[model samples]
Target: LAEHVVADSVLVPGVALVGGGPGDPDLITVRGRRLLAAADVVIADRLGPRDLLAELPPHVEVIDAAKIPYGRFMAQEAINQALIDHARAGKAVVRLKGGDPFVFGRGMEEAEALAAAGIPCTVVPGISSSISVPGAAGIPVTHRGVAHEFTVVSGHVAPDDPRSLVDWSALATLRGTLVLLMAVEKIGAIAAALIAHGRPADTPVAIVQEGTTAAQRRVDATLDTVGEVAKAEGVRPPAVIVIGAVVAVGPDQQP
Candidate 1:
């Protein structure tokens, strides 16, 4: 059906890398939802909530490429191959990723692979988890008095240069917040880095999990104890970590 719609356009044999948004089904954009509905094959990650999957037509094929804690199924290469394979078969493929496709979802790598294979590709942007998670938890990444700026860091960087990717010293000097996405596993190391580099040990920290979802949960504490509280509270990965004086103001308190 999608092929028919694009039959005249030389670009029908392509893949759509769609962002499924951050866990919450409602967060999915109308364009993303429409593309998903038209997809012949949908490849999704763990963070792409199952609710979104259920929205697909019974006839559409849904593939799980999710990277979960216990399951390390498909590699980037394998996922790329799968996308190409389906596209070559004249299938309208949708790589349904959690959050924005380009934001740390490795959508760029996949796009490069598809391009190499001469596959047409387009992106459908969705809300990024880093900022949305914090906002949904009643914590603004930036505030008038509390923060004039903010930095977003990823945990998937070179282990030796995580600090280099972000200047802890500058972050310490700025009156702003630090948003760490995918850094749940390195909370201890990150906290230590910021503290050692001059960010106050008592900087407020909050970890929000399953953000914007019905099951959303939050753990709040100072930088000195966020790591401990996160562990003790059984906070899982795929959580958003917020640090700064801004979060100190109660959730109801606005900037």
Candidate 2:
């Protein structure tokens, strides 16, 4: 594996996994931005700091991981191969992902593939939307004396789905704040499962759409009403759903 180090902000010819932060371009880290600016080939996702793509030099090759010539987005294997191919060609590659690479970003999978291919992979952390999005909506996942702990979970799969690995029963028993990503469509099932277990139906819940972006909107409801509220409001994906008493905690408390 070609081992490359980011020395004095200099990026060598290898693959750098840069976290583009939640949704705001300004939220991207200094290191992430610097790497993007110097990248010879940037493989980007739909969720990252897309605004920065226009700033890249015309000579840089920008590959949309979510879109390909075949009319279907590139799959994970294809993305890994793209990185390897670009880096093998001596081009500095940047795999720009949304939020922290390890936070449900399939970053570890990419890193493993790169390592297997003997490619030097650099991981740059970004602010996860789990916490940042809630905070942006004026809700803290953990508040002093309110929620002592916070758990971040992916709601991409419904509780009734056999593909789901999450222990809804165990999660219902926890007293900490629950931050759900990709759960808007399955909020009803999730709420039912949680309520069926041990979670209180009256627990406060806040759904923040578009998170920290300019289109951010927050909707409030109790666990009993959240499922319907989400549907009634036409909540969409990329929204952060916060469940627990912390939703009602500060000056930004929602109705």
Winner by lDDT: 2
RMSD (Å) per prediction: 3.8, 2.4
Candidate 1 residue pairs in backbone clash: none
After superposing candidate 2, which stretches have Cα over 4 Å from the reference?
1-13, 69-74
RMSD of 2: 2.4
State the lDDT of candidate 1 residue by residue for 220-249, as single tens digits.
Answer: 888889878888898887799999987877
Q: What's the TM for model 1? A: 0.88
Per-residue accuracy of model 2 over 207-252 as CA lDDT, tens digit each: 9998878899999999999999998999887899999999999875
User: Top TM-score: which candidate number?
Assistant: 2
TM-score of each: 0.88, 0.93
Segments in model 1 whose C-alpha atoms lie over 4 Å from true places: 1-13, 67-74, 156-166, 250-255
